[model samples]
Target: MRKHMFFSWAVLTGLLLVAIGCSDVSEPTTPTYETNLSSDEIKNSAFKSEFPLHYETYLRNDESEIMTEYGGSVNHNKNDGVNPLPEGYKYAQPYLKNLWLGYPFSYEYRRARGHTYALKDILEIDRINRFSEKAGLPSTCWNCKGTKMLEWTDEYGDSFWVKDFNEFREDVDLDENTIGCANCHDPKDMELRLYSVPLKAHLESEGKNFSELPRNEQRALVCGQCHVEYYFQDEKFGAAKKPIFPWAKGKDPEDMYEYYKNTGDTNIPGFEGNFVDWVHPVSKTPMLKAQHPEYEMWYNGSHGAAGVGCSDCHMPYVRLDGKKKISNHHWTSPLKDPDMKACRQCHTDKTPEYLRERVISSQEKVWNQLLIAQDLSVKAHEAIRMASEYTGPKPFNYDELMIEAREMCRKGQFFWDLISAENSAGFHNPTKSLDTLASSQQYSQKAIDKAVEAASFTTARDLAGDIREIVPPILEHSRELQMDPDHMASHKWFEYIPLLPESEKVWEGNERLTSENAH
Candidate 1:
């Protein structure tokens, strides 16, 4: 009986090795193509004839109607709590407009669509100043929009970054220039390559070379090129407005905060040598606005620490033709797949329903804490605003206390923004997400205490109320709304900003609309 069992086990092991050897799913092999395209080809369509199968999957990014419980490809307003479907969703965060007041994000910010819409969406977004001939952003804003950066950078060098964003609007092709194959692959041999200058520079600064890293790490790095947190360089640094990843100290929220403290040339009394994204028009506090930091948030999380790269879940391998396996190019949430095949790739024992429920459960906890942190942050801002304007008897350390309050407000909001801006809804790092929110609440509460103490507790009652009622969500705002006298007078916070001069839309997409070409 023992001899028979040993022979059966040996035969099973041999069969397994044969299966692994025949299947590309077990170990990916480099695909060879005979395309005669130019090495510098940036157009998505240019590679279609040579790689039809891959191109078909790439075009799948155009599907934008799907919605997960917490996120989706629908291009809806993230701040609207009352609207429905394509316009807004039930899971909306109401205070985004109030929190981001005075910044362009307050003008218009929406849930992101798929990668195919990058160029088109940016051209139409209100955040870019469509009402004026000059876009309010620098050309550096185009860094992640498309592959045209390769040609633009080669032609203009570092000078490409500081130019007006609108200058290249008419110069790009909507379908061809949007993010595609060339952004992550070398057309010559189809090997993964880094096209983002910011990411490349960051890797070099760390004395690491992308090509030398393991293939799994390279897969994540390709996506990290744009999915990570970044800020434009101050003029005091090299190439003004050039995009830079703040990874000098480390990739954690606390590490990034420490790095920003001395990276800028700002000379404001308390903000000296500090990087300030914008001054909160209401709180009068210098603030740091965090962009999506998915890469940072995931770096030390459960999967990343275990050597699972982003592509493992987001771009799962699939036999699209029912023969050769290829990485699915329709980058999106794994929960969108009915089978949750991506999760099952590693979690083979769990059912799709079970995996999805776990994700939503974690997100629900983070979302609740996120709202609480946001409320406290808003209260802190209001407390500072009231305290600064107080005429009552003050503490001897009023000035000192007010400065400390502002500092806390800054720290609290930034910590909150780090998690708020990340795309995973806290599933990326649940422990870190909850911990960060707790810190944010503590700092914001401290700010409120200091502000109240600075006023000798005179304004405590003024700040005592449901924050939702005290600071109603700003439901409507835009460059156009800012010009309307009635709209400008609708909110107390609006009183801080001057009304804009009446203006008409000057451009649409890549076209400069003159009377002859106007729609």
Candidate 2:
């Protein structure tokens, strides 16, 4: 009996040791992976044979049909409320074209596709002027599109940024150059490394090194390389058109706004010290356009403060072969999965439906407030436009009052854009989102009041009614529309922009076209 018990005990001990070994396979770990590909490999296909599962999952970025309540992979017009399906979504924002009248964004702004389409979308996007040989933008626009930037920057150095965006069109390969493996990886050993020059510069400025950061922090920083807010460095500072994150003061809206106060060489009155992205054609306000700032929005929020990295939710670990777990390469909304598997990883007790409802509920409130703020912003612009054109006797302090109104209009619109441009629909930071919108509304109202005061109350009655009726949303505008005299005459604001000369699209994707190939 004693001998039999000893043998059973030994068997149980051996089983325990085997279970311990298998447990490591179930959790994600940085196992050493050796791919013989060059350290310079930027092509997605180069890593396919070596890491088949990861490559397979990465291809899922091509699935653009899926959508959640507020966001999805569908490449629809974000400002189109009149169209259906692939052309538009139910929650479209109507004021986008009006808000961005003078900017390239007014031409065509659509909901983004997955990262795999980044190169293709940017090439075809109406925001880039394709009709002209000159792209009308700096090469800096290509910074976030692909891994080829790694090669381009290496070859051209600082001069790469100021080059015409169209200069490199014929040299890029869509599939290979689209954002992929090499962007955040060291091809030598599959370790995380920072490839974005701006992100690296920002970190180093703060005396932080990417390698020294905790692994969890490194995961979020990889996403931050492209996801954070940035501006092209004005020539006065250093490298002209080079992108720089305005995180010197802090990551919050007010902090970045403060940092922008003295970053540019724009000598326009009232905008002397400010970094101006563009001057609003209608309001004549110096504006700051916020890019998609997911990283900034999430940084100090609930999940971020609690130590959740971007990958923890967007790229949850899953068993592809039903054995070893890997971080899913298909980066997308956590709510996209019907099971809410990513959320369940942390909130194990909550049902998927409950969590989803909570998210949509927060978004609904935010969306409503966002519309209100946008309406006020439109009213402010109208007020300023009227005040600028007023012919009656002006107040003694009219110049000062008008400057204050313009400043308010600038701040209000920027605050609105911060939330509007962010992809999360306020789920990333609901408190910050709602607060910013509320502040935007107040600033817009103040802008209207100051504009009226500047005009000595002459514009109050004109600005009092429903804003939608006052300035109907510019439902359609594009490079094609600008070339048509009738279309340019259709709107009062269209007068601010000169009509484009008749021209054919000179380039599409990576292909430069002759008349035979032009569309």
lDDT of 1 by residue, 114-166 (tens): 99999999999999988776788899999999999999988998999999998
TM-score of each: 0.94, 0.94
Candidate 2 residues 1-519, lDDT tens each?
A: 999999999999999999998886765656787779888988889889888998888999998998899999999999888898699889988989999988899999999999999999999999988887788899999999999999999999999999999888877889988999999898878989888999999988989989988888998999999998999999999999999999999988888888988998888887797898988899888888899999999988898889988999999988888797888999999889999999999999999999999999999999999999888999999999999999999999998999999989988988999999999999899999999899999999999999999888988998889988889888899998899999999988889888988888787777877553344
C-alpha RMSD (angstroms) for model 1? 3.4
lDDT of 1 at 100: 85
Model 1, runs deviating above 4 Å: 1-29, 32-34, 515-519
Candidate 1, lDDT over the whole model: 0.90
